[model samples]
Target: MAEGQEKPKRLYQVWKGSNRFFCRGRLIFGPDVSSLITTIILIGGPAVSFCIKVNHTINVNKKDGKDSNYWYIVLFVAALLTCLDILFLLMTASRDPGIIPRNTKPPESEEGFDMNTPSMEWINDRTPHLRLPKTKEVIVNGHPVNVKYCDTCMLYRPPRASHCSICNNCVQKFDHHCPWVGQCIGLRNYRFFYMFISTSTILCLYVFGFSWVHIAQNKEGILKAMRKDILSDVLIVYCFITVWFVGGLTIFHFYLICTNQTTYENFRYRYDKKENPYHKGIGRNLVEVFLSKIPPSMNNFRAVVCEDDMVAEAPSADHVRTSKEKIDIEMGDKFSESNGISLPEILQNLHYDDLEGNSKDKERSVDFDIHPSPFVFELGKRDELVIAHETENIHQV
Candidate 1:
């Protein structure tokens, strides 16, 4: 018998040795050490609390000659809620959060723009005036929206998407990163996340009420009985206090759903002069966020309202080509896709001053009789040196 027990104990130790478990090429258990500890606490804490409460109820019922029917019903309800809480928690923790797919192709209009062609009526009022040179700009819902290219994801971030520094992925309709849950609250898993917190709040409330009643009914007063049944009463009090925070979160999420806003959007644009562009009516917002079965990012609609004044004025062709050549010289032939710098990183550092400087200098240099065309200057290993240009932007030197 001792040998049989030892064999099983050795097997258990072997199983527990690894931090990961796989089933059919899927990770069924284990993420990281912190998550593992969190999972154990979430699943184990409730289970142990339930067991202690059940044991205490059984003992006290026998002493009083009372049936355990009420206690059994309360336990049954609590257990059911626990199962649901675990189910939603796991679903939220494991599921994908609608990461935007990386853009694979270069952005160019399939057909060249025809100014003569009739514009789409549905285009945003701000669309007609928005112009970004050497970059694709699209008109959506009357607004001219810049199609921002992402360097890390190596794709264009569609509107309403932002890069999560923690996850290192662009999540569409990103809500927020929840450390407590050890995951991002985003498009795909948001429903499950909401359900988990809501259910957990209910479970906590139910357990607290039942445990309080059980302790109160004892011959001793609530405080003395609580001291006597320390584990069960302590769990009840802990859950009772915790329920407020969880319940508040549930209520807050419900408000966000109603407003058709994510936690990210709420924080980012909370005090912005404009209302949330995504805000449909309250009825539609709730349906869209919570009740609607449609996938959140399926439509991929970007709700940007661009201002007309922000558009850049087109520069002369000679200046544009000359500046382009100057930039190419400065960047050199080595700045290819495989180069050290990423496009997104370059763009992030790009300022309106950089673009304006080249154009302004070209015009200024011509006026001062410095050169007919802008001198292509390179900041070499030592310092700035001017490189002569032939045939202007006609060909690279």
Candidate 2:
């Protein structure tokens, strides 16, 4: 590309192992492959141990002239649990983690409004000071919660949405990134992820118990057992330790589901005194989080506001007639006192720029919009402004 020419936008690539690739962002696979291989090994090791123990138990029972029906039952239960574990694992690993789409049509209600269409709604008295972590702190339902904004997606994020650095997209109801599953625990796959952990923990305990029983039935106890045929005994010890980790995760997620809190919120808002807004009653929370039916076309909804809409009402003039025309609209006291209107807490700290960059010879005109929240200002020579998307971490100044 020539120095002055714009670079072609890179096409977003989906993760190779994903079942569907509807989200537009870079998919990272470096850590995923290893995590997947580890999960397979963990699942396979127990089954192999069960098979070896069953064979050894059958042989001992035959020599001692005892019924081997108990061993068969144990084998059946272990196999069944293993299958369930695999099923949920696949569901979690491949399912879309609820990617929030970007670059669609502007919302219906905001359609007729241009950049200069001023509304008293932005300066209303009912706004709250509550800030969501990574979003435009728009007052919704009387509270100033953060509306979603992803710099990577170059779009607004919806409520209960967050960006996964690993997946490189904003996910709805984001729980946490799970290395074990090689995926994000999000709205679409969170229930299945929980089930997988719960079943895996149960399977470990069940197989451990049966393996111990088979080992105890041998002529020599675990201590005196031969070094060669102690595979069942070894597997029991492994499960005994591994179960604690998996069981702890299951219990933690169970508590999260019951409280209608995500793993992200649990860590981020640990000390906040206010109750979680998403929480309902315990039963309702469980039902909604686990059993709610998701529509296939949920990803189709998008947030699209064109650059043209931003500059439609911008002034054509290059230079203001006087320095007095350059106004600072963000200071709530000055703006409110001058205009005799109370500004909302969100719009109280607004600032305006007449020029795009530090060049004295060139002039610019600007207009601001709060929905997408990027204040577009025309720069000298260029017909468009190319301000980078602001990240949530930048405090509203």
Candidate 3:
């Protein structure tokens, strides 16, 4: 509250996920972002070696009265691809991956439950538990799908949404947690993730193909040429090995994009066995994945929020029951003193059969006169009190 004191910390500072923020929460990265260092070294190191080898080849060719313009073009293209791949990697890792906001408490609405059909069971002396089903059926694409409730997030996950255990947050259209980029591949960043892998594959092949060409320019045999430039030999081997990994990933993701399937769903659900609910035609699927507008992030990581308001602890069942008991006791005492009849006597004398019969008969005759009281109306509003009293009697037995 002091005028000279610093402002409260932003939401990113107090964020629950295992994510790091930079530029005052303008940029976000997963906890494993250090893995990107290895990725950069693998891609950058090979590209740099390729450029050096090409430059040396160009110099040798120029001295032999040959045109070295072709080598210059190769070098330029290699450098451009390397830069583009790095940009894609950064875009994939540094941006939000469509994280869904967490709920402070379980939803209290009756939309998902059939309250009219009660499956109540009396177990010994304890109150009947009003259990809610874990999975709710939702209609998606004209087919019924079961959406599970997440206890940690306190919500039913939307279609294609899943919780990433590493990030400790629910992500929309979650693909998988990619350790290479140190981020979750989800709706917001999957496009850049695909681009990063595809570009890396191209860059690796470029270096691999050019390094061999640099060696072949020698007048000697292939073995002799490789021996002369050891760096080019190393780059050829490195690129050859790396291409398999990145190239395979690129091809796999291309299939995923065409079929409108996430890596998570493809492996777990195995849509190959059954009809894919999400699949449209190939053209429409590609447009949905790549050309669709990405949804905005749900969290404002840099926004200022009150410290007290930030901690929304859900009340326990026992705590709620205790509070309700206190209210019932207080209301009962007040009602008993105002009206001559005690609360228990009024409840005992109330006959549901008589009330039902009176409703059926238009000109009904009553044996006893009924007086409408504000306390009776107040008691009618507290239905939980009757349940609590019945539970107490059961316990006494």
Candidate 4:
């Protein structure tokens, strides 16, 4: 690929090894099950347990011996049902539904050359369902080609997506790959990912509250319950440990969500020099994260979520503009208060005597978006000269 030209998408053969025998996506099952297990404990387990207690109480009040036993059966059945539901979801989430035709419409482009031929296919053929990595081979085209690879898709990965080794699979839309999820939390599963997090939090809260009730109720009967040492009572102890674990994590994640930061970012960007674009403080973060306030006026989602194939494609003027504008906005602002905002924290932590690099420009815009950045932070005060330097770096790069 030439400078400023799109890289052609390459094709690759799908790994034909017995997918079921070894590891296709089946290998990921461990992590998948881990996520589901957490979700089940955090989501359905408490809900069912609560229902069981209610039903058990009502049956006893009605003086119906058969009905009371029926409630116990109900508890067993509900537990079984929840387990089955999780199994079903796992199976479905694991399958590779063959590739659907790409309906990718290019953003309004000023550059010429219509590559949007309906017949062209950029994904894997064999495992249309699986993402196969592609490789390159030179071939002559009748006409001079602007790029061997499709501009929309980056380097030619075959059925597999060109996952940022960091994110792993070339997840669909590939929203910043999360290592914890153990899969690409992309467009296809974005809803599930969010649902998983949201539901997990709620389940934790419910389990935490519900466990307290059982702790109180069972405390009087703890020795009596231990007398039998039945598996059902064992589950209760497991539930108690689970309650504390999930409760702490869920509350921490809630704080992160309200601030529009992922757990990944919480540690990942702690020492970074640039500011996070998504952050808007606790109140604004909560509003946007929970309420889905996708700032109509500030639609910057595209910067991070274009197709995996499209990353490193020549960034459009609009993207450049968005990036430039964001940098300008950052540079224009003053890092005033001493709150927990990441940029300010980074700035505040720096000491003039401890710094060595150029510290002349303190008014430059600070952007945390660029990778392999050259524009240095104000180790002392490079901020002034940094924004324009960033704007230039972005446009030229």
Candidate 5:
């Protein structure tokens, strides 16, 4: 509030999701950032050993008056692959994973709903009050698909979008939350994530193969050759185990890419059982995943947001009440006072069968008060109305 003082806070400082920001908010990471440390150790440790072994092999070849240039090339290729793998890993981890911004409140407008459509009719008419449907039918690629409403995000998830529980945010075109990368794989960074794993597979194989070559060149038994350079044995075992992980991941993701499916969808939806509406041919799927231009991030984490825009002590989506729910609660309180009955007692006594039988009689006995207003209203106007109502009640008291 003072002159010459910073009044606004950067968006990252007040971000509600369990994400970490770095490089002045230019990079975003998930809650398990420490996983990246393990990744680095796994990569860098083996690379150092590989380089040392290759260099030593080259030196022995030179001392024996044999061509060492081949070994030099092998060392160079291994180093290059290691560096490339690390670069891809960083790209996948730091970039935005296509997080969708959270709404300040649940949407009140009937933008996506059709009240007059017979298909929208409730299956259960026994309910006391109307509530939003759990799933809505959407058309994707000329086929009707049902998309579930995410209660935590308070929105219908876009086609292929899902909420990452680890990141605590809804991501567009979500693949999965990858702990190895310490990031969610989604629309923005999934390409890089795939590249990282594939490159890692290549690097592991490269090291594994050359480590064997180093052992074979000794022309001794396997045990004697391994005893001569224990690092080679260590690398062989390490890369062998590592290849199964990263290599298997590479193949699995290749299948996903070719099929135009995400890990989340492949596992949960099981497109094998049903037709995959998103499947273009394999060629087109490859182009869509690898060659398509990525969209820019929805959030500007470094942007300074004013106090009015900042939602201090913001409630989670589950705790935040919708306008309809608030109205129902207030009406319930008023009804309880008038009838000299607690809200819980009234609820316990209310029966669906009785309501169905006495619907016509209750309509005659109960006088209804209703108002017509625009479905959408400005937040400022809503705040003003709330303040005025509170002031009137204070005066009465």
Candidate 6:
């Protein structure tokens, strides 16, 4: 749009990750056999409802063959899922998802130094952006606005803020983008998202567990469910077989979350072709991610790391580090305690990064930089934009 200015290369990501789902990039929480997840949800939602209608309940009076056959179908699906979970675990231990590590180029401490090898720390080890200029705050819509323009998403952002491409807004408490639920988890919808996952896991386990009862109630039906369709009908046999695929994904994700690891970190446990300077970004970054600390960004990437973790075993997952143990964090002088939620004070409670925000932390951090080009959330807008264009077209036509 300007002289001598070339258009930026198109960056595409349908999900939370930076890479396309089908690329050699690894799958973190999805189905073991790849895009099997979409099918599982599609089928599970309907199949479960159908089974409930016919059987009257998940725990039906199954002294009869039909009841038992239904149970076997459940078990058949569950067992298959167990195997997928095993595969997911193995993949986590041996695969690479290509995580973008924190930047060590500026070293937070040294601005002008050019070094070949950046420091080896995790993404959770650095502040996301340079501190805003020390000045009085301006209140916007009754709330104080802290940061200037975000170079990453290319807009002025507020504290406790982030840009969600799926929603195409700077959401507070930015969580991962989810495709199945058709929403980005932000501060407002995060509770529902967590509830959805927690409940969904229970549903999977519930269905999988009942399969055992089905096998016990009717031995013949159980065998039939397990039997590979010798009829050579791929469609019919797959009904039960796909159970293994979906079940595995659900269980695998359960363990990973309980132990406090993202699909990204789980894969990072294996090999990464890119240099992971910020190897321990998880150590305590969840608080920041969940709490939503927006800054004047450069790229869409945020470089900040949290002081401590919220989960019980948070230290192991969020605090996990590869090398370089020493860390100093800085806190800014101005911090808001709206509704008694004080970030600067809370950040002070952590062991990593100094509590003095401003020019202080910028002097010490080694591995982290905010990435530019936040998500291009253009969903739901198509209808609105289309309507406006159509109005103009009608007038012209």
Q: Best by lDDT, which number?
A: 5
Model 1 lDDT per residue over 1-397, tens place: 5754532222112221111323322332223325735754765586568756776787778898989887777767777888888888877765556555332222222211223221111111223342112222322222333334333433434444566656655565678867766666776788888998899888878777777777788777877888887766677768877888999999999998887778876775642654444566788877666775534332111222223212122223333233332221110133222333333222232111112113533322111110112111121211221222221121111
Each prediction's RMSD over C-alphas, in Å, is 20.2, 14.4, 17.0, 18.4, 15.0, 18.1
- Candidate 3 lDDT over 49-160, as tens digits, reads 7888788878988998899999899989998999999999999999999776665433332222323221211111121332233333433444444444444454445556
Q: What would the per-residue lDDT of candidate 5 be over residues 123-180, giving only the tens digit for each residue?
A: 2222213234344343454444544445554444555667787998878778899989
After superposition, the stretches of candidate 3 with alpha carbons farther than 4 Å from their true spots are 1-6, 108-131, 311-397
TM-scores of all models?
Answer: 0.58, 0.62, 0.73, 0.39, 0.73, 0.31
Ranking by TM-score: 5, 3, 2, 1, 4, 6
lDDT of each: 0.50, 0.54, 0.64, 0.34, 0.66, 0.33
Model 6 misplacement above 4 A: 1-148, 151-160, 219-397
Against the correct fold, how does model 4 do in TM-score? 0.39
**Residue-wise lDDT of candidate 4 within 34-136, one digit each (tens)?**
4645555554655565566646555664784434564455455545545554554454344321111111222122211223232122232211231211112
What lDDT score goes with residue 393 in model 4? Answer: 14
Residue-pair clashes per prediction, in order, are 5, 3, 0, 31, 0, 43
Residues 64-164 of candidate 6 have per-residue lDDT tens digits of 33345654565456445434533333332222211211111211321111222222122232333322221113222223333332222222232323444
Candidate 3 at residue 147, lDDT?
45
- Name the TM-score of candidate 6: 0.31
For model 4, what is the error of residue 65's alpha carbon versus the real structure, in angstroms, after optimal superposition?
Answer: 9.7
Candidate 2 residue lDDT tens string, 19-43: 2233443222323646866896798
Weakest lDDT window of 10 consecutive positions for candidate 3: 388-397
Alpha-carbon error at 328 in model 3, in Å?
41
Candidate closest to the true structure, highest TM-score: 5
- In angstroms, give how far residue 113 of model 4 lies from its true place: 20
Q: Whole-model lDDT for model 1 versus the true structure?
A: 0.50
